[model samples]
Target: MSLIQTDENIIAQMDSYMQRVSELAPQIYKRRPVACVNTFGCQQNVSDSEKIKGMLKKMGYTFTDEPIDADFVLFNTCAVRGHAEERVFGNIGTTKQLKRERKETVVAVCGCMAQQEHICDRIRKSYPYVDLVFGTHVTHRLPEFLYKRLTGSGRIFEISNDNNEIIEGMPLSRDGKIKGWLPIMYGCDNFCTYCIVPYVRGRERSRASADIIAEAKQMIADGFKEIMLLGQNVNSYGKGLDEDINFSKLLRKINALPGDFRIRFMTSHPKDCTRELIDTVAECEKVERHLHLPFQSGSNRILKQMNRRYTREDYLELISYAKKRIPEVSFTSDVIVGFPGETYEDFLETLDLVKQVGFASLFTFIYSKRNGTPAAQMPDPISREEKGKWFSELLKVQEQISRAKNADLVGREFTVLCDSTAGEGRLSGKTLSFAEIEFEGNENLIGKFLKVRIDKFTNLLQGSVIE
Candidate 1:
């Protein structure tokens, strides 16, 4: 394994950059500066973006929604799939003219895409005008990266080749004033053959539980009401540490925190979804009654091929156990259709499992090949047309499930946490079950909760807010 996949080495880099980053802060504030961040990929990336924004703000830069008006444009990119890569490349190309127009403008690229050797190679060769590059691990070092860009000394600042470690004290600008993403852990230890996370994010290293609680406490003090605990694999949190704390224990600890905030986590592997964890989830009042368990494929054969480390029966049992323990508990899942060698019957099995489980919502994707994954080299690949057809079929069934689930909320009341801006005339938010709710309210309702009654819904969504 690469040294970048470990923890000890990363802590050293943190101290190095923290000292340098602070020294560079005053320089950025001296100039008339503006920054724009274009993000792609997961909640982890969103959390990274929040920190990036926080870092830039500390350096006295304002944000702009338009790239053309900005003095500094940063592409917080993703390489999770081919389509995401294409979008970033397009954005970079389009931004090139803006850089040429304003020769002093700092153009940089960062995120998981920066971790890949090939992706970095292309950026260096074809996009030399790009002043700075960094990765997931180097988000805290972003201030330093930008510092270099502001001066004439700009070059690629990607420190992604080093080992992974938890960088405490990184500030964040929460997207929602009332909600925040708290990372319990970072990176992945599971090298699922189709995944580039372990390669790009490097290995699993957990933050100290004490630090996590301190952050949560601070957020609570700041009056935040909802916190989503983010991780590539949340269940694997604390297992990599010396303290021997498990995820369930962490959840229970947070639930017992001196606050009324709701707690949520994501992307659990079925192999690690133990009865204890399920029971703990059922018992914790603060823990939301929703779980985002990603079943990449339904067929045991295909699962084995993806190196999922669990059989189909194992997943079904876990689902059954979780539902039994918390009947009111709803589920959302990640499913990939048309994986390599995935027969029609295999696809049907996934459909069957989805219906059997009756997920509150499902995030479905067509199997897009990733360059460095083992599944990428496999023979008998699913064709684009076949993948498209399968995706459509999967969407049809999922839409039905979603509609039925939303319908069940009729005449029922739910507590929704409002985060986004109100639309033309109504407020938009998410319920505890992660259901989308749009209700009428004043602008002041944007960062608070409302007891909402399901008033009506279209074929796609629900309408709400208590009388």
Candidate 2:
């Protein structure tokens, strides 16, 4: 079979699987089967799980939060960090007893972690109770895999290589009603030495702009208050497409859509970020005034080692331009404190960059090595103890910066989308700049936009609705 299946062919195949599952489900399941899908990783994984749940729902499965009460359990895994993988394994191990108690219960593992050969081998040998194992490429074939598992096809595993196809029209059972995740592109072409996303997610391929715009319109009509455009690196979107479009052009199209919703995207590659993109954000009122550009490392030498393709100076230049264009722009970034072969001086460079940026918040990591990545094979003299200390130091510095940033917002009023309840009578939401604030309100205010006045900051910004 060809690697890239046509969308019509895949859709037809899925329809067949849906029919077969419907036929088999009545015979096998006494009542509606309850599925517990535990997603671990990025928003991409969460979006993938939504589609998985959509398929399971078509197969007559009701959802549950508890695995013990579930007739089907799926672990949508992550390969970003070793700690994440370990947590997935630990969670999977807990299901062994559930499988023992309910022998008919189906256990499946899928996603980036399952795409790895070693992870599959380990699951096959160590966790024999897992009935179905598929990879990132074959997520669209979940119904087929589940059908085979149900029809006495013992322990199915389908981890095919990347086909570089963009499959659309898959049903989705989203987790939220207020916010929606719309993936504009998939996979990464950059292949930073310390990362495993390109290896597992395959090559970069963007969804056609028309499809994306249609989805955005539907999201707006569905009353979605915010639409988060997802990608491995969103700035690299519109590559490999036939249209004369790029990320900025795409944003303009979406921003032109009639809606009260806000636009947001993430993990923008600093190497690919451009003046046009920054200008687009400044001009587009719908796009949030926040950029989550991951610099990874501040030292040019360390950046060269990691193959991040941009220096601290280049990153700062982009930041400078963004700030000039949008004065209220809030920035968040990902930083690695202790990369391989990084010295104390290199660490200081990272800290210096953090202070210079004054990010609203930061997501810091201590550099977890992945097996297939080039950084894993590099020489590392830094001890785990030393890395831990450096990690703490970075966190302390960032906390001070974060507190100061939040402090500046005090007594200021901003419009925020109330998305969730905080405590009993309190509610939590995010400002246009992406800073979260908690305010006192009833549950009726959950999905509505409200004006909130920041009163104080203690860990989080405490506020009151300006009624």
**How would you encode candidate 1's per-residue C-alpha lDDT over 1-467 as one tens digit per residue?**
21213344454654455456456544654555778888898888888889888877665667898999887888888878899999899999988899789877788888898888898889889988888888776677776666565555758657555646566665567776687899888788888887888888887777878888999898899888888898988987786566758899899889999876888897788888889899999999888888889988878889989999998888889989988898578899999888889988899889888888889888888887899999899885568898889889989998898888888877778888877765677888887778887777787887777888887778634566764
TM-score for candidate 1: 0.92
Top TM-score prediction, candidate number: 2
Which digits, one per residue and each the tens of the lDDT, describe model 2 over residues 1-467? 22223489888899899889877776776777789999999999999999999888887888999999898899999999999999999999999999889888899999999999999999999999999999998898999988888888999989997567878898888888999999888899998999999999998888889889999999999999999999999998888777789999999999999879899998799999999999999999989999999998889999999999899999999999999998589999999878999998999999999999999989999989999999999999999999999999999999999999999999999999999998889999999899999999899998898999999999899999995
Off by over 4 Å in 2: 1-6
Model 1: colliding residue pairs: 4-163
Give lDDT per model, in order. 0.80, 0.91
| Model 1, runs deviating above 4 Å | 1-31, 460-464
Model 2 Cα shift for residue 418 (angstroms): 1.1
